[model samples]
Target: MQLGLSNKDQKKVLTAFYSLGEVCGTIWDNIV
Candidate 1:
C-alpha cells in the first residue's frame, strides 16, 4: 500500500493536508 513518496514529497503532502483541514475547520466554525 506504499506510494513510495520521497521524504520531501511526504512533507509537502502532510503540509497540504493540514492546510486543508484548517480551511475546513474555519468554514465549519463560521457555519456553526
Candidate 2:
C-alpha cells in the first residue's frame, strides 16, 4: 500500500528515519 506522499513529505519522512537511526546508534554505542 502506498500513501502517495509528495516529495516534500517524503523528504521529511526520510529525515525523521535517519534521525531515529542516529539516536539508536548512539544508544547502542553507549551500551557496547
Query: What is candidate 1's CA lDDT for residue 8?
Result: 93
lDDT of 2 by residue, 1-32 (tens): 35799889988999999999999999999999
Residues 1-32, candidate 1, lDDT per residue (tens digit)? 35799989988999999999999999999999
Assess candidate 1 and give its TM-score to the true structure: 0.89
**Stretch of 10 with least lDDT, candidate 1:** 1-10
Evaluated with TM-score, which candidate comes out highest?
1
**Alpha carbon lDDT at 23, candidate 2:** 100
TM-score of each: 0.89, 0.86
